[model samples]
Target chain A: MRVVLVAGTTATAKIPEISAAGADPTLVGHTPSADAEIIEYGDTVRSPVTPVSPTGCPTPAAITRAVRELTGFDVLTVDAGLAKPTAAPTIDVGARPGRDIREPEPVPTAPGAFEAARRMGLALPEDELVIGETVPGGTTTALAVFRALGETFPVSSSLPSNPTSLKEDVVAEALESAGLSPGDAAHKPKLATRYVGDPVLPVVAGLTVGALESGSDVTLGGGTQLLAASALARHAGAAGDLTLATTSYLADDVPELESAAAELDVDLVVTDPGFETTPLDRYAAGEAKEGAGMGGALMLADRMGVVDDVEAATLDVLSRLDPQAVDGVEDGP
Target chain B: MRVVLVAGTTATAKIPEISAAGADPTLVGHTPSADAEIIEYGDTVRSPVTPVSPTGCPTPAAITRAVRELTGFDVLTVDAGLAKPTAAPTIDVGARPGRDIREPEPVPTAPGAFEAARRMGLALPEDELVIGETVPGGTTTALAVFRALGETFPVSSSLPSNPTSLKEDVVAEALESAGLSPGDAAHKPKLATRYVGDPVLPVVAGLTVGALESGSDVTLGGGTQLLAASALARHAGAAGDLTLATTSYLADDVPELESAAAELDVDLVVTDPGFETTPLDRYAAGEAKEGAGMGGALMLADRMGVVDDVEAATLDVLSRLDPQAVDGVEDGP
Candidate 1:
C-alpha cells in the first residue's frame, strides 16, 4: 500500500499566506486533518471543514480519492504529526506538530518520529510504495533544510509568486536562531530536522530510507519537500531504487528542479496531471501547485493505465462536495 | 497479518493485586507498553522494563515472540490506549488510556475510538485477522462490561489464585457508580464501554465488527476480553464468519466459558499450547492465562504446522532474556 503522511507545523500559522492548503489561516491547522479524512473516507465528515484553497481550488486529496476509486492501489494516511489530530484512521508515527523554525528546537519529536516511521517503512507489506506528504508550509521547511545542508536550489511554492524573499527571510532567521551555518549539518541530516526543519521532513526521509532498504520500489511524492527527503536519504547512505515524483506545475515554476534532482542522484519523474477545461486547469495556471500527494496519485493512475479516467473522477468527487461550486467553473470557448 | 492491540487502564492501579500482567502495580501502566514492544521487536528494546508477573512469570508476549519466530505469520501491534506510550512501532486507533471504572465515565474516548477502529477494521488489508488485546486489569473491566450488557460469564485472571471477590466488588461498585444496573446497556454495547469498560474493549469490538463485515475472517483472541468484543459485535448487528479463540488455560479456569460462547452464537476454538517439559509449562499451572494474543498466535502457529517448533522457540527466547532465569526452572524429572 502507498502511504501519505499528513502533518502540521506552526510555521503555517506563523506565516498563514505561506500555505493555501486550507481555506484560511486558522483552518491551516486542520488541513492535515481534513486531508487525512478525504484520503481515508473520500469525504470530510469527520473534520469540521474541508481542505481547499482560500479561492476554492480543491485539495489534492480529491485527486487521490479519484485514484482510489479507479485504480484501487491501496492508500493509507500516516499521521506523522498534526497540531489538530485527524478524525480519520491513521498510522501514528509518534510525533506532534512542530513549532515555527525560528525556535531553538522546531521539532523535538524528530528522532522518535524518524525511528518509528523507519520501522513502519521496514514492515511495509507492498512490493511498491509511494511515500507522500500533506504538510502545509512544508516547502518552507524544505528550503530551510536545504540551506542547512548547503544545497543552493530554490524550492517551489504553492502560491503563484515564488515568495522567495519571504521564505528566505524566514529561513535566515531560523538558521540564525538555531545557531546553524550552511553545511554545518551536511554530514548529520537528522540534525537539520531537529533544529530548523518541520516534523514531516525527518518522517518522510525515514520512511523512504527504510522502505528502500527493504528492497521495495519507493516513490517520494510531492515537490520540494520530497526533494528534501531524497537529499536526506542520500546523505544518510540509504540506497535502493528510489524515485522522486512530482507535477510539472512545480517543475514549470522552479527552474532548478531538474538540477536538484540530478544533484541528489535519484530518478525524478514529472507529471502533467492532464486536466482539460476542468477546475484542475488551475494546476497549470500556477495556483495551488501541489500538496496532499496529488502528483504521485496522478502518476499511479498513469501506471495503472487509468489516467484518462482520473480527471472525470476528480470532477465527480468535486461535484459531490458542492454541485454549485463545480457549476461555477467557466467553460472556455 | 495478525494484529494485537496493547492498551492501558487506571483500573489496574485502583486495586493493585487485581492484576499481575505487570511485575507490580506501578509496572501495570507500563505493561501494555512493554507488551507492544515485545511483540514488535521480539524483545523489550523500546520499553524501559519487561512485562512479567509480580513473581517474574513472563508476559504472554514471550509466547507471541515464539510464534513470530517460528511460524513466520506476520504480527503487528495496534495501540488502543496507553497511559505511557510504547516506543515500538504501532497502529494507533485514536483512543487514550481510560480511568478506573468506578468513575462517572471510565472511557470517554470510547465512541471516537470505536468509530476509528471500525474504519480501521473495514480497511483491513489482510485476509485472516487475529484481533487480540493486551490491557492490564482488563478482566475486571470485562466483568463490568458483561454485567452491564447482561452477560454472566466469569472471566479469567493472570494470577494462580483468582482475585474473584476483589474483582466482583470492583465491578459491583463500578456498576453502581455509573448509575447503571445489570443489563442496563444490553442493546447499547457502546454505552457500556463509555461508562464502565476500558478503551481496548471498544477498539477490539470495532475491529472485529468491521473486519467481519468486510468479509475478512476474524478470530477474536484472548480470554474474557475477546468474548466481550464478540458479544459486543453480535449485539451491534455485525455478522460474518467469526470465532473466539483462546487457550485451554482459560477454559480450564472459567467453567461458564463454553456456555458464554454458545450464547454469543460464535464458534470457540481453544488450544492446548503444548509446552510440556518446557519453561512455558507454567502455562498449564495457570500463571498467566491467555493474553497478548498468545492463544491466537498459538492457534495460527498450529494452523501453519509449526506448533512443534513453538516450544523450542519459547525456550530459546526465554533463555535469551536471562540464561540464569531459564536455568532456575526445576527439571520435571
Candidate 2:
C-alpha cells in the first residue's frame, strides 16, 4: 500500500502576504486545512474559501486529488498545526497552532508533535510512504532553518516571482528573535526547528526517521521544506532509503535544490506530469508550484501508469469548482 | 506487520466499585493509558499510579508488554475518552470523556470518533490488527448493547466474583435511560453505541469496519467488549475475516461466548498461556480476566514460539512494580 500524509502548519503568518497559496493573506492560514480536505474528500469540505493562488490558480491539492482518483493510494491528513480546523478527519499531532518565526518561541509544541508523529510512523506497516506539507509562507521558515543549519539555498515559492530577498530578511529577524547566529543550529540541528522552523518540519522529520526505522522506503514529498526534513533526519542519526520528490517548476525556480538533496545524501525524483503542454500549463508558468503532495502524487501516478489521467481529472475538478474557468477556454490557465 | 491498538474509556464511573481493573476508582480511567504506555514505551511514562487489580494482581498490560518485547509487533494507543490525559503518545479519536452509561445520552461524540477512526483504519497497510480496550465499567455497557441488539449473556468481570447481577441491573437502567427496549438496536446498531455503549465500542467498531475493508485480518482483542464491537460491525454491514480472540478465563466464565461468536459468524481463538502453572496464575484465577489485548498478544506469541516467555517477563514486571509480592516467592498469586 502507498500512503500520502499531508500535514498543515501555521508559521506562515510571518510572510503571509508574500505567499500566493490562498486568495488573501488571512486565507493563507487555511490553505493547509483546505488542501488536506481537498485530497481526503475530493473537494473542500468545510472551509468557506477554496485553496488557490492569488490569481485564482488552483492549489496542488486539486492535482493530488486528481491523481488519488486515478490511482488507489490512501491519503491521511495530519494536523501538525493549522489556524482553522479541518473538515476532514485528521490525525492531530500538534497541540497548538504555530507562532510567527520572529517570535522567541515559534513552535513550542514541535517536540511533542514530532514524538507523536514518530510513534505513529514507527507503527506503520512497511509500504511506500510520502510526507508532504502546506504552510503558505513556509519558504521563509525553510530558509531560516537552512541558514541556521549552515546550508545555503534560496527556497522557491508558490508565487510566480520568487521573493528571495524578502525571505532572507525574515530569516534575519527570526535568527535575532531566537538568539542564534547563522551556524548556531548546525551541530544542534533541533534548535533550528525549535526556534525558527514551522510545525510541519519537525513532524515530517520525525515521521521520516520512524518510517525509515520501519523499513519503509520514504519519499519526502515537497520542495525545500522536505529537504530541511531530510537534514533533520540525517542530523538525528537516522539513515535509510530517503527520496525527495518534487516538480520541475520548483527545480526550474530554485537551481540549487538538486545540490541540497545531494549534500543531504538523499535521492531526488522530479515529475513533470506534462502540465506544460496541458490546460493547467500555468503550473509550468509558475502559478502554485507545489504543495499538498502534488509532486509525490504525480510520481506515484507515473509509476502506476496513471500519470496521463491526472490532467483530465484535474481539468474536470477545476471545471466543477468554477464552471466559468473552463467555459472561457483560453481566458484562465 | 501485526498491530495492537489499546483504547481507553470513562463510562465505568457509575460502577467503579465493581471493577477491580485498577487499585482505585479514580485510577481506573488511567488503566488503558498506562497499558498503552507499557506496551508502547515499556513502562508507564507519566501517570503516578500503577495499573493493577484490587488484589495487587498485575494488569494484562504487563503480559502484552512482554509479548511485544519477545515478538516485535507494534502497539498504538487510541484515546477514545479518558478523564485524565495519558502520558503515552496517542491518536486521540474521541473528544470528551464518557458519561455514565445510565444517562439519556452516553456517547454523543461516538459518531465523530467513529468516522475519524474509520478514516485512520482505512489507511492502515494490510496487517494483523488487534483491537483492545480498558473501561473499568465497560461490561455494563457491553451488556446493555448486547441486550439492545437482542443478544443474551452475562458479561464477565475482572474480579473473581463476576458481578453478573449487578451488571445486569446496570444494563437494565442504561436501556431505560436511553428510552430503548430489547432488540431496539437490532437493525440500528449505531443507536445502541450512541445511547448505551462507551466511547471505546464505537471507535473499535469503526476501526474494525475500515480495517476489514483494508484487507487486513482483524482480531477483536478482549472478551465481551470485543464481542460488542463485532456485533456493531455486523449491524453496520461490514463483513470480512473477523476473529474474536480472548483468554481461557473469559471462555470459562462466559459459557455462551463461543456461541455468540458463532452466531455473529466470527471465529474464536482462546489462548491459555499456561498461566495456571506460572507465577502470574492470578490471571487464570480471575483476578484480572482480560484487557489490554492479552489474549491476542498471547495468540501472536504462541504463533511466534514466545508464549512461554510471557510468565517470566510478567513476573519481572510485577516484581519491579511491587518488590514485596515476589520476594516471599509463593505468597501472592
Candidate 3:
C-alpha cells in the first residue's frame, strides 16, 4: 500500500526511518525528504513556535496546508476544537488540593485538511489510506485524549527509557488542575485538549471520520496516531476498515485502545510483530480489551514476510520522497 | 564535597551524550570521557544481555557490578533468583497462548561488601552517598518495583517520548495479572517483585536498609536508581536523612516516588533542569533550595560545571578516582 506520511513536527526524523523500509511513501513537508517525494506545505513552521510542552498544542492550519499541498485525495477533517477557557484558570490554581479536569473537543486541524481534500474531489487510488501525525508531547496528549473520551486508562505513568518525569507531572498536574479527576470520563475530548493536550488529536480524528464516511480502508500509524484513530472511530459510530500500525511496545500497553476497538465492533489489524497475542487472549489475560473497533483494525503484521524490518520500511518510505533520486521518474514542476 | 560518576555501558552510541555535556567529567568505562578522569570498566560482559523487546527485564547484576567496580563501593545485591516454576495443572485448559513472561528474583551478592564498609569505619561524607545505575528496560522494572511497593499509581500507562510500549504494558499486565489491584495499602512489596520485577529491587532495598542501619545520608541517582531508592524506603522499614537525586521527570510522574518519600518521610531533590518543574521553577522563581549538603559536589573542581551542557556532576565524581588529576596530589592506594 502506498503511504502518505503526514508530519506534525520533526518531519525530517521520520523520513529516514520510513524511506529505508522499502515502501512507496511521500514526504509532505516544506522541506524535501532526501529520498522520498517532497510535497512542500506552505505552513512549515519552527518547532519552538508551538513549544512541545506537556500541554503545548500543535498548529492545525499547518497540517491542513501540508495535506492540501501533498495529495489530491478527498480528506475529511474532524472538527474537535473547543475553546480552552480552562487554560488560564488551571494555571491560576497552582498546586491547589483538587482533582484534575478535561474537556472533550474533537481535534480541529485534521478535519479541516480532510474537508479541503473532499472539496478538491480527491479519490484514493486504493481502498485504504494510512494516516499518521507528528506532534511533540503527543503521548501525554494521547493519555489526556483517551481520558477525555471516557476511557479509564492511566495515561501518564510509564517511565520509558527516557526520564522525563517532569513532563509527565506537568501534564498530570494540568489535567488535575483543570478538574478532570483520574476516572472521571464525563469531559469531552476538545476540553481536554485545551486543558492538557496537543494538536494531533483533532487531525487524526478527522481523518478517521472522513475515511469511515467514505467507506475507505485507513491505516493509522504510530501509537499516538492509533489513539487518534480510535477517537475518530468512537465519534463516527463505526470502526470501518482502519488499520493501526505502530511499534510493538504500544500494542502491549493501553488496553483501552483495544477496548475502544471492541466497542466499535470492527476488525482490528496491528502492524507490529510484538502484538502476536490473540485479541481474546489479550482481554482474558488483562493485556488489552478490543476497543470500539478492535476486531476490524487489530491485526498484527508479520514482519518476516511483508517487510524485512519495520524500521527499514519506515526508512524506505522516507527515501522515496526525493524526485531527483527516483531512477525512472520525471522532474517535478 | 566530591562526586563520583560511573560510566558502565561502553556502547559507542551512548557515550557522546555524556562526553559532549562538557563537564570534563571522569570517564569510567573502557574508553575515557573527553578531558577528564578515566577508570575503565572494560567490556568484560555485554550489558542488556537480552534483546530490546517490548516486554523484558533489565540485567541489574551487570549494572550493580559495573557500579561496584567503578566506585569500589561495597556492593549490596538483592537475594532473589528466578526459575520457571510449573503451574499447578488442575483446571480445564485450551491451547496455551504464545506469551512472553519474565520472572525477576532478587539475589543479594556479597554481604561482605556491606560488612567491609562497616568494618572500615566509614563515616558519612559531607555530601551524601549518591548512587546511579544504567540498565536498559529499567523503566519497566521501575514500574514493577513501584507497583510491588504498593504504590497505586498506574504502573505503566503514560508515554515517555520513547516509542516502546512493551515496558509500560508489562507493568500494567503484571499488576492486573498478579491480582494486586490498586487501592490496597496492605499489599506487600516483596510479593509484587517476585511476580513482575528485576533484581534491582532487593539490592536497592538492601542499600536503604544498610544506609539507615549505618545512619548515613544518601542520594539515589538516575530514574531507575530513584525507583530502587523508593523500593528501599518502602521495604526496609527505615527512614533517616535520605535524599533522592534523580532526573526532574521521575520527581514529577512516578507518584510512588513522592509517596515513598512521604512514607519514609525523607527529602526529595531532583538535579536535572529539563525534567524538573518545581526545581526549574525554583531556580527560575529565585527560590532555590540550597542545603549545606545539597550544593554541587563536583562543582568545586575546574573540570566541573556544565560539561557539554548536560549535567556531568556524576562524571566529575568519576574523575576524582584518579587523585593526580585533582590538584596534582596523588593519593596512594
**DockQ per model, Cα:** 0.10, 0.06, 0.01
Clashing pairs in 2: none
**Interface RMSD (Å), every candidate:** 7.2, 9.0, 28.2
lDDT at B127, model 1: 76
Q: Write the per-residue lDDT of candidate 2 for residues A1-333, one digit (tens) a residue.
A: 445454665555546466887777777778887787677656564565677777777788888888887875655567777678565545566546778888888888878877877776775544768888888777788888888888886688788988878778888998999999987888555577889988888888888888898888899877887888888888778889899999888888878888888988999999888888877887888878888888888888888898888889888767655443343233664
The digit string of per-residue lDDT tens for model 1 on B179-293 reads 9999999978789999999999998888888878788999987888889888888878887878888888888888888889988888888888776556667777787878988
Give me the runs in candidate 2 sitting further than 4 Å from their true place. Answer: A1-8, A11-94, A99-139, A142-164, A171-197, A200-333, B14-16, B316-333
Ten-residue stretch with the least lDDT total in model 2 chain B: B321-330
Q: Assess candidate 1 and give its lDDT.
A: 0.77
Candidate 2 interface RMSD after superposing interface residues: 9.0
Best by DockQ: 1
Ranking by lDDT: 1, 2, 3
Q: Is the docking of candidate 3 incorrect, acceptable, medium or high quality?
A: incorrect
Residue range B258-287, candidate 2, lDDT tens digits? 888998999999988888976667778887
lDDT of 3 by residue, A112-210 (tens): 443433321123333566554433234455665565556644331122222235434544655676566643533343344444444445445554565
Binned by DockQ into CAPRI classes (incorrect, acceptable, medium, high), candidate 2 is: incorrect
